[model samples]
Target: MKTIALLVVLTVVAADIEFYKTANDNYDIKALIANATELQAFLDCFQDRAPCSELTASYKKNIPEAVVQACKKCNPSQKHMFRQFLEGVKKVVPKEYNEFRQKFDPENKYFDALEKELSKF
Candidate 1:
C-alpha cells in the first residue's frame, strides 16, 4: 500500500511538472496568469498584506517554485507572448491593466526588472 501511494504521489508530481512545461511551451494565458499570480502572492507574503487572489486562477492551489526557471528556458517565446498579452490587455481593457499595474507595482519596478531579464533572451 505504501508503494502504491508513493507511486500515486510521484505520478501527480510528474503530471504537474509536465503540465507546467507544456503550458510554458505554449504560452497559455491561464498558466501565465497562474505563475504571475503566484509570484505576486509571494511578493506580498508579508505581515500586513492580504494576498492578491484576484489575479490568480482557481485551480492553481499553490505556487510552482520553478515557474520562473521554466519561463527563462522558453524566454524568447514567452517574452513575445507576454508582450502581446500586455498589448492586448491594454487594447481591450485599458483601465484594468492600469489598475493592475498600480496594485501590483506602482512604481513600475517589476516591469523594469522583467524587461531586464527578458532582454537577456
Candidate 2:
C-alpha cells in the first residue's frame, strides 16, 4: 500500500512539473490574450468565492501571508488574462513574481527565476 501511494505521489509531481513547463512556455502576452477565456477560468479557480474554494484555501495554507494579501489586489477579473494579472501584481508589488508563482505556479522550476522572468518584460 505504501509503495502504491508513493508511486501515485511521484506521478502527480511529474505531471505538475510538465504542466509548469507548458504554462511558462506559453507565457507571452499574445498567448495570454489569445487564451483569455480559458485563462480567466483558471484564475477564477483561485479567487475568493469561486468553485475551487478548497483549493484556494490549500494555497493560503502553503504560501506566505504577504503573497495572499497581495493577491487580493492582483485578482484578475473577467477582463484579464494570466499575463495581465502578473503585470498588475508587478505594478502593485513590483517584484513578486515568485510570490505570484507560489499561488499560480507552485512548482517554481522549469522557467526563469523571478528576476530573469521579469526582465523579459
By summed lDDT, the worst window of 10 consecutive residues in model 1 runs over 58-67
Q: Which candidate leads the pack in TM-score?
A: 1
lDDT of 1: 0.46
Error of 2 at 64 (Å): 4.6
- The global Cα lDDT (0 to 1) of model 2 is 0.42
Q: Candidate 2, which segments miss by more than 4 Å at Cα?
A: 1-30, 52-85, 88-121
Per-model TM-score on C-alpha atoms? 0.38, 0.26
Summarize candidate 1's per-residue lDDT along 1-121 as a digit string, tens digits. Answer: 9999999999987666432233333446544444656434533442115554433332122222222233343335555554554555555556655754565456655655554554554
Q: What is the lDDT of residue 104 in candidate 1?
A: 48
**Clashing residue pairs in candidate 2, if any?**
none
Stretches of candidate 1 exceeding 4 Å from the true structure? 1-24, 27-74, 112-121
